[model samples]
Target: MPTSHCAYDTRLLVITLILLRGARAYTWSFKEAPSQCGQSTVAVAGNDGTPPFHILIAPFGPSPLPNGIETRQILDIPFTGNQSEVQFQLTYPTGSQFIAVVSDASGFASGGTGVATMVTNSTDNSCFDATSTVQFDFVFNIFPTVAQVVQCQNLRISTPNFLGIIPGGQSFVIPEGTITTDASTGTGFSYQANLRAGTTFLLMGGDVRGNGTGGSVTYIVALGNNDGSCLSNNSPSSTPGSPAGATSSSSSPSSTSGSSAGGSVPTET
Candidate 1:
């Protein structure tokens, strides 16, 4: 009886240790903007073992306007993590409609890696009447030691029209040696380009089909060396590029309008 009890105690101790290890390995925190239309800044520690951060954004409340012309919310999420992959899993309530507006005419700068996965419910009511009026601009300043390679991948977009806002748009300036691949099976888009040190890449476009909600979109932008190792890694070879910043542009789309929520927008040259 004594031997059996000793063995049971040992097993219990092992299990407790495992649980504690898991708790330490993964740690996350929650934050919200003062209002739905405000900007939110998420700061992540570099080389931390924490999993991808999750952001829960509430849906827009009932609009006071009878026509619902100004019934929209603007959210600008700027991530600041050095030598770390800035990743976020965003969740929105049903009937929530929003668009990725171009806040800066120039574009946001990247610290070599930026990734976001957004999940929301679909709604017929969009912020815009037509896709032509909607535009998205993503400009990244890539600073690398060697010939750095930047790859942008559109893993999944729920609405086919949203693909127009991706890199393949007309305003996009593809640098030399850039290889663009259109997915043969689905409505996916991807591009790989080699950028010299201290050069900027511009990706801007408008979709003819209006942007609606109800599904999800997964987009990934990563910078790495020729050997294919992510520059976001915390190794000696990992060249920590400059941090990316997103600023609001003066030009606003006439189709959609909203007031800023007073969140500080990070700015990088």
Candidate 2:
């Protein structure tokens, strides 16, 4: 087997070959992002007798990856470890192509964790950006709460590679707080606060397709225009403690004279 350094050099040559030899068009590979399980893992493969690229993250150990994809814009690897605390060790070689996003978030994490893969060129003799290497020392935790006069806190949102918020229309606005970019989701990010009860918010919550997480529900939300309403699942609403009942925080209703028992607003799916 070629030494790990040899593998890195080879991948660099492959990137250059694709650029110079014009192998098809745009270069493509996996888009690494942070996860909820404190780590991310994927098995990257090469064609023919080529030795595949193996990426294992911290927090959760991963296995040799399996490869199968229909497109190049996205690369899907079999990941069986913690999704949070995703970071690459780059055991292959030094002169490889990869990007790492850090600086502020580079050194942060409380509940889960965050990892970002920026675009890195391999022209230099470095596996990662000369400025940033793959790191996984952060532990971020985000909690959705229901408190009156809630203290403003930064919510760590490890935006997914393909998940996104609805554009052109008013993005979701909660009444009590404000939203801003805690960090780049990739294309960018947004924050939300000052939210009122029942305020409909929007976000690209990871991809619906190839989402390996089970018991977790996925949906395509619809938004309305001025005086518009957010679209949601038509499934029957769930009461608290209902079987696998709803657990996401939601805005409450307008002030109306009613018994406190009626105050408990069940979250409709």
Candidate 3:
């Protein structure tokens, strides 16, 4: 019954951020594939202060698996347009391999404009100045043993750090097409966000696990201008004065992170 829980909701542990040079991306995720999958090429335009840009995510069918371990997949696809940052590691798995769909080809998305793909699968990609929308699909491959894929998502990568999605303190390298995990190599996930201005706006997150279940999601926002830097200018004005922001001031942990396994991520609301 809750809209979103602010504490320990694993589905909200990872965040994927995308920023474009002239537009904003309209991001949407799916757990059980869209009502229509890999069928439509129609792209809807998104607004990001700059001009309006439309884009389409080409469909990439269900993944091919290896074990009967109930395949589990986690994708960190990115979409972009104007200068917008999407919080990924804060909403999905860590070390998770993501497919880069950067292209300038005439696709349905981008309103006939063009998309360029750029993903070295690098770290704290600040120069992610490249504009393109990435569609990452994950297949949960943990069957015969468990049904739940993720325990949490969106863990606040406020500071790009080293680490990937960790379940029960375990880590896994997430990529686009394949869902994989290493019980021995503990997963590592860490992130740092400049917010350009840090917390000045509302940020929401969600986690998708291997079992084909949409984990859970939560949203947080900056309340006030805590510093005097143009970096802190990105925050929305309506936020509370007590929230966190200002490129000059570092953010203190104010929220909780969690995930779901046996059942849905406990509503953090």
Q: Give the TM-score (vs. native) of candidate 1.
A: 0.21
TM-score of each: 0.21, 0.17, 0.21
TM match of model 3 to true structure = 0.21
* Residues 188-255, model 3: lDDT tens digits: 23222223222111111223322113221112222234433423433222223322111110111222
* lDDT digits (tens) for residues 1-269 of candidate 2: 12222223322322111111113222122223221111223222223212222121111111111221101011123222422222342322211111111111111110111111212222223321233322212212123322211112323333332221111112221222333444423122323222222322222222335321111111122222222222233211111121210111110111211111101111221
Give all candidates' CA lDDT scores.
0.24, 0.21, 0.22
Candidate 2 colliding pairs, count: 36
On the 0 to 100 scale, the lDDT of residue 215 in model 2 is 10
> Any idea how many clashes model 3 has?
97
Instruction: Output the worst ten-in-a-row residue range by lDDT, candidate 1.
Output: 13-22
Query: Which segments of candidate 2 are over 4 A away from where they belong?
Result: 1-72, 80-117, 124-224, 231-269
Record all residue pairs in model 1 with backbone atoms less than 3 Å apart, i.e. clashing.
Answer: 38-261, 103-249, 109-244, 121-214, 122-213, 122-214
Give the lDDT of residue 141 in candidate 2.
19
